[model samples]
Target: MDLRQLSPTLAVSPQILPDEVPALAAAGFKVLVNNRPDEEIGAEIDHEVMAQAAASAGMGYHYLPFHPGQVTPQLITDFIAATTGRGPVIAYCRSGHRCTVLWALSQAGKRPEPEILEVAAGAGYDLTPVRPLIASLASRRG
Candidate 1:
């Protein structure tokens, strides 16, 4: 797991296996967020498998299967609630792109646009494509 820290509370990774739970626990991530949809990858790393592993390792697990262009407010809300003021979190997707987007969107009001874009870019994700959505989410804060 090549996890990259986007913030002190949130990290992003390309993928994670059930066996990697121990390392995640050692890494101090209290929560595991699986953002990859089931169909995109094989069943080997599905939600149930990860959830079981996370639970056994004493970590919280949340599966919010986010497909491109299908992100929702509820998903963001759930993710925020799961990670906010909690221990470190590691969120994963196929290439960490979707997970990164989810993290950025989740921080719509809490973080400004420049900081959000910078953090995404620093972690090798391009938020330019989601500029409109970011603006919309940020505007909703007012």
Candidate 2:
């Protein structure tokens, strides 16, 4: 599991199998978010399967799928709602790129761009492409 810590309570990864759920729970992740839609890779990792695994591990599971260049404000809002105060969350996508991008965009004014980019870079994700969007949304923060 190529886990990358995005925050003290948040982590992102590429893809995960159902068998990894128990270890994830043991690692202290209380929530699992599927940013990848089922259509992306067919029925490879069904939501129900992940949900069942998460439940068996005593964790919460949320499926919020989005494609590249499709990370909307509403999605970010949903993510914020699903993850707030939920403890460590493990969000995954194809290569963890979409997950990381949406995470940084979700930060907006909540965190400085430099901080967001720095954290993402540490996780091996480049946020330069969405730098403009991050700046735009960040400005909307009050």
Candidate 3:
């Protein structure tokens, strides 16, 4: 798992195996957010399996699956609700890019644009392509 910390409370990663859940829990992550859809993964490592692993490892699990371009406003809203005050969370998708994008978008009104971009860049993600969207969301919050 190439876990990339985007902030103190949030980290994103590529797909993680069920066996890896305990390590994540041990890492102090109280929640595991799955951004990968069920259809995209094998049953051996689907959300059900991951969720069970998370439960056994003593971490909360949330399924908020969606493709990269399929993100809706409701998805972002749910992402915020699922993670806020839930303690440190590790959200995973195929390459972690989608998770990073979601995290960036969720911060629109709460954080400065430059800081959001900078944080993503530090985590090896380029949010430049989504800057306009971020800006748009931020403007709406004003």
Candidate 4:
């Protein structure tokens, strides 16, 4: 897994395999968030498979799948729900971009947009396309 820490509590990664869960758990990740849609991959690495791995490893698992363009307010809300207070979370998608984007959107009101972008950039994701959406979300926070 190419894990990239976004914050003390959250990290983003490229799609993780079922066999990788135990090692991730051993490495201190308390939650496994699968952001990649099942339709995008085979059953070998689908959410159910990953969920079972996470369960056996005693880690929390959340399967919130969505395409990058399909992200909605409710999705961001759910992302926040799954991530907040969940010890250390490792969210994954195909290239880690979708998961990183979800994390950035979830931070819209809670953090400054520039900081979010910088954090994502440091982790190797470019959030330029979602810049306007981040601003919009932040504006609606009040």
| Sort order, lDDT high to low | 3, 4, 2, 1
Residues 1-142 of candidate 1: C-alpha lDDT, one tens digit per residue: 7887899889999989999998899878899999888888777888888899999999999998998889888988887887787789998988899888888888787788999999999999999999888889999984
TM-score of 1: 0.95
lDDT of 2 by residue, 1-142 (tens): 9999898888999988999999999999999998888877756487878889999999999999887778887899888877779999999989998888888988889988999999999999999999999999988884
**Tens-digit per-residue lDDT, 1-142, candidate 3:** 8999998899999999999999999989999999999999899989899999999999999999978688889999988987889999999999898899999999998899999999999999999999999999999996
Query: Which residue window of length 10 is worst by lDDT in model 1?
Result: 77-86
Which candidate wins on lDDT?
3
The TM-scores of all predictions, comma-separated, are 0.95, 0.95, 0.96, 0.97
- Estimate every model's Cα lDDT from 0 to 1: 0.88, 0.89, 0.93, 0.92
Compose the digit string of candidate 4's lDDT tens values, residues 1-142.
7999999999999989888899999999999999999999999888889999999999999999978599987888899999999799999999999988989988888899999999999999999999999999889993
Which regions in candidate 1 have their CA more than 4 angstroms from the true location? none
lDDT of 4 at 66: 77
User: Which residue pairs in candidate 2 collide?
Assistant: none
Clashes of each: 0, 0, 0, 0
